[model samples]
Target: MAEILTLTALGDNYIYLIVGAGDAVVVDPGDAGPVLLALKGNGLRLVAALVTHHHGDHTAGLAQLKAATGCRIYGPDSRCISPLDHLVRDGDLIDLPVGFVRVIATPGHTRTSVCYFLPQTEGGPPSQPAANARCTRPCPADVRPTTGPALFTGDTLFTAGCGRLFECDAAAMHRSLAKIAALPDETLIYPGHDYAVEDYMFTLSIDPHNQAAQQALRHLRDAQAQGRPIVPTPLAMEKRTNLFLRTDDPPLAAALGIRTDDPATVLAAVRRRKDAFQPS
Candidate 1:
């Protein structure tokens, strides 16, 4: 499995470095200074860059990094970003030095938005144990596949919030989110920004009685207080705690005045409310 490192850039934006076998690939490098430092410190070769969209905050460092490291740039075809070495669409598979990533076109925040899915490197069917060995022993955290297949949601899915619809309509965004929702429960999600606390606070206001939301909010708040990074949320946990993902739930629908069971409608309503939301 590749070791993932987070480089905080452009304030809240996150830049990810996937390192394995002395080779590395950067995801959405909003800035180059931190990435250069990380590469120098780790002594890893920058092989390629994976871009999710054309947003400047996500691709501003592309030119500089490519110049310094001679890394290949991969992204959706767009005029906003220049000198693309490869144009990827949905279901495209990108082979890297470590593991491969499958492209998922998730166009909600922008028309060209895409997501990258990398399956966890370990934890398939358990091996047969000895006749006298216990079959129910829990796996050690160190041995477990914590770096399992992860999704790089550019500006589409935040921790508890979804991105603003800049180039697509609500229906399109809903379909895009649905694609993400179909992934395995264990798929870890690494969004583009560190908006977990703010998104959680907004969720608490709407669903104050939601235990999962309350717990997640408290956990994020504590993490923030401790200066820990808040990201890579599990898909199963997000399915339960994220209000944006729960728009189709009957209780949430009712709370949001969405009488119809249509998921797009409910999601649109919730999104509008979020757009106008002000955290207390």
Candidate 2:
């Protein structure tokens, strides 16, 4: 089983270090300094680095980490980002020390954006569904254990929100989100940025009376006040509160004054509204 270590880098970006099995893998190393320190602190050897997209914030540390640790870099085939050691696409499985990662293409924020899905493996702390029903499992004192399958969503999907469309259209983004929504509800989501508080606040603006969204926003506010991370949210909770995931709901159409039947149309309208929406 792989133990995931969350390291905050570049202000809001999160870099994950997966240790266990026999080797270690780092995902989206935005800075070489923090990643190197974390590896040394844990006495772990870096064997590989997984990249979810070509975004500089996600790949800026790739070259440095690769040089220092000789870790192989894996990312999309797009030329916009740094050269990758291994070009990955949809459905490709990459092996690591603890567990293997299944590559899922989720292009919307960028044409080459992708997400890494790690299946649940035995080894970490016992599953604590109640505690982690809304946020990522807290790191244990010792080496963390595998809780279950975790999704490393790089700017494609955030808690209660989604990424800006820089490369694809609303229809494409809707399709990509549908793929993630189809995953088992228990799947844990590790977003690239710590945007839960802001995103949840935005949700409240659009869905003022939504009990689930309201309660979730309150819980997130408390977590923030306590300096607790609001990420690694459960997919189940996201399904309940994420406005982007509810493009098909009739209420969304009514609220946005859009057609109800076509998911893509509703999604497009919502995205446009969000782009211009100023959170009060």
Candidate 3:
């Protein structure tokens, strides 16, 4: 099993290191300083780096890290970004020392945004390519596992919120979120930023009656007070607390005073509300 480490950079951004067999793969490295220090401290070799989007905070460290380690850089097919050794697309898999990192296209935060899904292997390869797995409308039943699948959602999905629709419309973001919701309930969510407290607060603003969100907020507060990192949230916990993932929930729609049952429409309304929201 690969060991995952979270490094904070640029104040709020998170850089993840997946270490196994003395080899490490970093995801969305915003700063090379912290990553390099971590690699040296752990005495691990940098094999590859995965990018989820072309944002500066995510890719700024790519060129430097690659220059230092000579590691392969994998990311979306976009011209805005540079130093990409491999340009991947939806359903594409990049083999790493830890395991296979399946690329799932999630364009909303940006036109080229993507998420990386790493499924756990018990001493062997997966039963089949995860790209071949069929996904249904709301959720997928085929991807569920007991434990050890991690989704690197960079600016796409947060603890209780989703990314702003920078280059795409609300419909596009909603579709991308639906794909993430299809992952296994036990799948751990390693988002690009540390926005748990603010996000959960926003979730409560939209879903005031959600006891799960209330409880989660309290837990997050306690974790923060204890100086613990609040991340790698389980998909099951997000399903219960994240408003973006609960667009189809009738109560949430009612709370928003939206009459439509269409998730996309509901999501648009919620996103607008969130855009205008001011935290107290």
Residue 174 error, candidate 1, Å: 0.9
Candidate-wise lDDT, in order: 0.81, 0.80, 0.83
Q: List clashing residue pairs in candidate 1.
A: 118-149, 119-149, 120-148, 120-149
Q: In angstroms, how far off is 65's CA in candidate 2? A: 0.2
What TM-score does candidate 3 get on C-alpha atoms?
A: 0.90
Candidate maximizing lDDT: 3
How many collisions per candidate?
4, 2, 0
lDDT per residue (tens digit) for residues 86-122 in model 3: 9999999888998888999998889999999999734
Q: Which stretches of candidate 2 lie over 4 Å from their true place?
A: 121-144
**How much is the lDDT of residue 109 in candidate 3?**
88
lDDT at position 119, candidate 2: 91
Best by TM-score: 1
Q: Where is model 1 more than 4 Å wrong at Cα?
A: 124-146
Model 2: lDDT equals 0.80
> On a 0 to 1 TM-score scale, where does candidate 2 land against the true structure?
0.90
Q: After superposition, how far is residue 76 of candidate 3 from its true place, in Å?
A: 0.1
Candidate 1 lDDT, tens digit per residue, 102-139? Answer: 99999889998999988775753222212213212321
